[model samples]
Target: MGLVGAATGPSDGRRARVRIADVALHAITRRAARRIDHIIGDSTQARRATELLKELADLLL
Candidate 1:
């Protein structure tokens, strides 16, 4: 399996704690860096993306 697949799962299947944390950060950073144009395709999508991005920023910065 991939790094993330190895990192997450039941206790018996989980990877090292450091590996899990690294994979989690790698995932969140990639997701948080996605451009709006790459994501929003319509007004409905735009509104939802806007709200969620705002919430993410509020929680992070």
Candidate 2:
């Protein structure tokens, strides 16, 4: 397994307090960051990208 897979693997005899909502939000944020980075690189679609990013931020928050 890779780094993320190993880190998130079955417990190692230790209690780790992790919230489901927090985990979901973290995954969503990572995905959004990658998409926004790609969109921001294209100058011609900037206006639409900005609007979409705002909408995504509103949903995430």
Per-structure clash totals for the candidates: 0, 0
Candidate 1's residue-wise lDDT over 1-61, tens digit each?
3454334356855544434457777888998898868557788999987899899999999
Model 2: per-residue Cα lDDT over 1-61, one tens digit each? 2213223336664644444465667887798777455547777688787789899999999
**Steric clash pairs (candidate 1):** none
What 10-residue stretch in candidate 1 is worst by lDDT?
1-10
Task: Mark the regions of model 2 whose C-alpha exceeds 4 Å error after superposition.
Answer: 3-13, 17-44
C-alpha lDDT values of all predictions: 0.72, 0.64
Candidate closest to the true structure, highest lDDT: 1
C-alpha root-mean-square deviation, each candidate: 8.1, 8.5
Candidate 2 clashes between residue pairs 3 or more apart in a chain or in different chains: none
